[model samples]
Target: MSEQAAPLRRERRTFALGLLAGVFGLLLVPTCTSCGGADESQAETRPLVLSTIGQIHDIASTLAGDDLRTEVLLGAGLDPHTHRPTRADAARLTAADLVLENGLHLEALLHATLDARRASARPVVAVGESIPAEQRLAVGGAGALADDPHLWMDPVLWAEVARAVARELSDLAPAAAPDIARRLEGVLAELAELDAYARRSIDSIPAERRLLVTAHDAFGYFGRRYGIEVASVQGISTESEASVRHVQELVNLLVEREVPAIFVESSVSVRGPRALVEGAAARGHQVVVAGELYSDSMGPPGTYRGTYVGMLDHNITLITRALGGDAPAAGLRDRL
Candidate 1:
């Protein structure tokens, strides 16, 4: 291998499951593949590791189970658009049988890296290709935001992504197709239940209170699915900045419309939303911090909101209660 493709070095396994299953390393990426040295049980071919960002990796792991060796390329809280691939990352890619990405222009940075190695790789799966155009939120505005890449925000849409992931993994590792299919069915059913739960939860809130204001424009699909009106300070891509004029406009809307709450995103700064709150307070209109939602990433592991289902459930519960809606002891979330 040349300097551009030299021998790869592996990082030491530094993390163990901790309190509340919270991950201590904010930027941990599972970088190593099997060395063909572990026990025979661990030696079973594992799809060379289906690699993608956090949430997709999480959902696929739940669906694919032990059949796939999953690795998240980006860590929990990094911005995907600006995430650069490290030398270790490139090594993971070259060693893998396949790669998975959201790819509605979501992983813009990774495109260059993938393209460079595509000729020699097994496959690079862009799961979003399977989504029905009408079902997805159409793009608007300029730059990376010119296309809406946050399609995974909606559970229904994400199920489509699961199907594509399973199909690609099955293609790479035929022996696991049977298992992937079985779990894919269960995964789709769970997603539907989640969708219904969110809809009912949002519906229970009075129509006037169904407004969702957040730090970034990652909720377009979500707002369209249920009836919430989503307003984010920044565009879909984290690289985009909210203009001063946009801030003043949002502040004006919050005060004039008297929105009960505004939300902060875990992956981004809350300064913009806080400004809106203060702007509201200055005019005698109070807006409280609703909850920290998983806009671009999931929560700390083992929390009520770590996985995809848990993430949406937490969001629904918070949005409903914060906006004066009620919640049953358990959402009528039934798995098919």
Candidate 2:
């Protein structure tokens, strides 16, 4: 088999096994009458919408408004790529009226749990997969060519995700469809502005210095959307390890291009990024770890950076400033 095809096959096999295990795991959970089915009191008060990531949770909450209750299973700094569903998570999945995940294997470990939930005739939506296949970027460069799951990095693409969430909310609560649509419109406008800001800010960077180096390839969509070149020490998924050769290659790039900053992801280990900095220093090229970027996860909950827009704003503003571009220290809404 070809080298590229080998990893792809392995990933598919792993995903299949995960799904099967999820199914059997769910079967082992002692069935509670209330757990197996939705609670009557909760449904009447507000239908629950559970999401795998905070980005989707924020979108659902915005569109649902007072009509539904929204919660995210993954919190700040949690890596969904490596996150396996606990027994408590399984129960929460079972109890939730609806489930939303980024899909496209972004939730690599949660696939089985999600599939198990879907098999039970429960409502589960992979919102990221809603994006048309052509619009999605293939995982390129020496690895299996799969769809990149970090669509939330691009505001324009994430707007489509918001629309999908709104549709789901509408179908879940037809009575509140109009209200959901209104909220979606506002969210869309805000995203459009964010997209503009990203473009303008990124464009301000000198052409040669517009390279974005990070711990992983999560920023592919962001680079494609804003015309910046992205290079990383790891592949699309955080599950993959950064090889010594890969780190040396990136360090070479940093030294060659004289790139100013490399970033660490909040959800990923700093070891890989730190390695890059150290590698560059050994070659007599100084590079700084600019700041932590929200990759697989967003900021802490109950803060502006915790929200989807805020997450992108933080990334865009941080990247721009670190690369010698101009941006407000407080970010687009002065909330950085």
Candidate 3:
């Protein structure tokens, strides 16, 4: 087999295994009343919204307020790209009154399980798909066009997702429609402020030094929205390994541009970013790993960084400060 074909084959194999596992999980879902199967009484009391990732959970929770119950399947530091559904996850997905996922293959491993749930006539929304096609960034190079799933990286795009979630929540619980709509208004204003803050913070960085290098290509939306150039060691999906040639190319870019700082993702391995630092050091460029950015996940629940606004505030502030820009040490609302 050719070198390129090897990775393609491996990806296909991995995806197949994940699908099989998810199907198996569904089959094993507990049917007994005592085994945590859907309690129709409880579900009717309070609608449960299961979000595939923290970013979606944050938005859903913000719009839902106390009207709905929101929970996240993937936690902080967990890479959704490689996460397979467990038996419990299958049960929750089955029981959820409404399911919200980033879609665009972000939850590639859970696609089969989510599909099964949808096939059963359960409500499942891929909130990221709510964004207009033209607003989404296309990936896959010269091959078939695919939408990048990391829309949450841009606050403006994320606001659209927030609106989508609001609509879903309102539909799920019509009685809460007024409350959801009110909360949605507040969330949209907050996201707009976040977008403006990100642009301002990023603009403060010196133009030549405004490049952001990270472990993976999760920040394309962020860079496009904030006027920074984004390069990564790995592809958009963390499922793909970083190629040596790609690393060397990035090293060359770092050395040639004399870029000061690179970033590591909270949910991704630091080896790739560290390798870039070492590669640049060997060339005497002296690059630093500025700080860990929340890419696939957010911070721990109940904390400031755990929230959607806090997550972006942290990223904007950290990137600005690391790249020699001016930003408040405490971030947008003195929360970071």
lDDT (Cα atoms) of all candidates against the true structure? 0.77, 0.92, 0.92
Task: Order the numbered candidates by TM-score, best leading.
Answer: 3, 2, 1
lDDT of 2 by residue, 1-336 (tens): 789999999999999999999998887775655565666654576789999999999899989988999989999988998888899999999999999999999888888888898899999999998899999999866665799999999989999999999999899999999999999999999999999999999999989899999888999999999999999888898878988998999999889988999899898888998999999999999999999999889999999999999999999999999999999999999999
Worst lDDT run of 10 residues, candidate 3, spans 30-39
Poorly placed runs, candidate 1 (over 4 Å) = 1-44, 142-145, 302-304, 328-336
Clashes of 1: 0
- Output the worst ten-in-a-row residue range by lDDT, candidate 2: 34-43
For model 1, how does the per-residue alpha-carbon lDDT over 1-336 read when each residue is reduced to its tens digit?
Answer: 566433332122222334324653432333222333455656576665655677788767776687777777776677777778789888887777777888888888778778876776557877777886666676665563354778778898888888888887788668878988998899999899889888888899888777889998999989988878999888778777889899888888777766799899888888888888887888888999987887777777656566778778777777787888886544344211
Residue pairs with clashing backbones, model 1:
none
Residue-level lDDT for 9 in candidate 2: 96
List pairs with backbone clashes in candidate 2.
Answer: none
Candidate 3's residue-wise lDDT over 29-115, tens digit each? 655544554566545578899999999998898888888888999998889999999999999999899999999999999999999
Total clashing pairs for each candidate: 0, 0, 0
